[model samples]
Target: MQQACTGDRFFTFYLLDGFALHGFSAAVEALRLANDVAGRPVYDWLAVTADGQPAVSSCGMRIAADRSLAEERDRLLRVAPPRCIVVCGGRMAPPPDRALEAWLRLCGRNRLALGSFASGLYPLARAGLTDGRRCAVHWEHFPDFSERFFTAKARQTAFEIDGSLYTCAGGNAPFDLFLRLIEADLGTDTVNRICEIALRERLRETGERQRLPLQARLGTDNAFLIRVIEQMEANLSEPLRLTALSPASGLSRRQMERLFRREMGRTPARYYLDLRLERAHLLLLTASQPIIEIAMACGFSTASHFSRTYRERYGCTPQQTRLAETARRRAGGRGNAPEMEHERHVA
Candidate 1:
């Protein structure tokens, strides 16, 4: 239905148990700034939760909602409903939550816009909101998401908007998405003024790439190690064997191990194992693949061996790790899981 008026666009951000504080704050601040810049409320926004309780964020912060899911529905209906609803901060592979699923179905029927931040896209995908729509998701989760939902076009964009659906890569993309919203509804001038007030850099256009180049993040001068790690990362599924890596750099396997340890402080095998694990971890979180399937993709010959190695490295079995990840998100903690830190961040 067409809006009865074209005044303030209403937005409701639904917070699952464990949402990211940074992403949520970014969305709120962007809207706040846009409203300030416009010299009027361009957006009428509200944060809501399942039970009218405080939802904890991944950054150890808690947000008190304006209303519970039930109470907010009436106001949401009255306030032009939601032109768009962005869901952020939750487990990537959440099992069916009937109440939450029902609400999303209603939104789908009403054509209220939909979106997600970071791994939050998992639930939306599970709820079947993203079918037949191009979506954007954080790059870390891209592999499993691609492998499972082969048909969905998942881009490495800061954000993607396909008709009423909107998605922003988690981290800082929320800032960009809201700025775009401001520019779309209010004007560009309002967005600029808010950017100035917030002391933030000007928003990157939607087409700009989301993540910085790897060499920059690593802060490394060792060209060889960087090259080798890059190759390993790019081929996690069909990773180069130790013998294969030898020829890639014209170095003996022993020489490669020595170089990796000298520069990266880990053996080549350990580093490679970690790389595969990181990819597996992301897929486990974002895609609905069975553990066996994910294990095979990450180069594990058997699920048992994969579980054992994952436990040894991550201090938890693969199933334990997955469960902990899901629980942490549900508990609203932004706990860091094992990532393929090809550089200094990997342990």
Candidate 2:
């Protein structure tokens, strides 16, 4: 990590198409408040886009950029560079942008800190910037991120700070990440005041899991049942048999069956099948992995079996889902995948 600098820390926000506005806002707001709380500009930031024009947000809002990638690169050459460069992304990962990838690599060569949110991490991963680095990926996108970037140590945590790289899961997770960064820069006293001003209840540390526990998500506090679900999630690629799961849950096979049916309103086998199908559905919509490969990854023996099961669960085949998503992207509903508004940075 670079030595922490005092005075002002300048940041550049590289906004990608279909970027999540909330994540970007959360980060900037933290720094904005830091300045207010400190009675000076402790932190400063600017927005940048590929064309130096306004960038559109995921929710259809537009934010004007302060400069273009080329302009920023020129500034990096002629002037002091930003303290950090952040990539902001939305729900879907856009297509690769060659120009953006080069810019990010340049940042790395310059030893500048790099940051990203949600699918924005894709660009960093593709540019080889996140290789062997710890990254925090939103749980909804964790499967695709990990599958595509095996070298990056992807975690389902709120955020991760590994060396010069910073990553945050999408949504409100950015608030926690930015707060930590602020705390690092200004100290605990200032952070506490900032939180009070923002009406934030507490500070969340690193290594916090991104998702709710299965027990909470399912509206049940049964420890044994939750343990079995965790096991199921961990072994999705090669499902465990009821006999194996029964021992782990401390219930006989028959007892497990009764418990699942009563609490979940489904047989244990049925519940397990649904879990696999749910994972398969998300991958089908968001990933480019071949149907057969997805089926195998989800533990189906054959593509035919996988397609049949998928159709029953989703009311459409995997191919159909892929086609629809393609059409949607082409129609500009999704602004096409992975575009950085022509500069092609991560996200």
Clashes of each: 4, 9
Per-residue lDDT over 158-263 for candidate 1, one digit per residue giving the tens place of the 0 to 100 score: 8887877888877877888888877887777777788889887777876567777767766676777777888888788787888877777777888898998887
lDDT of 1 at 161: 79
What's the lDDT of the predicted structure labeled candidate 1? 0.73
Residue 228, candidate 2: Cα error in Å is 1.3
Q: Residue 96 error for model 2, in Å?
A: 1.7
lDDT of 2 at 103: 93
Q: How accurate locally, in lDDT, is each candidate?
A: 0.73, 0.84
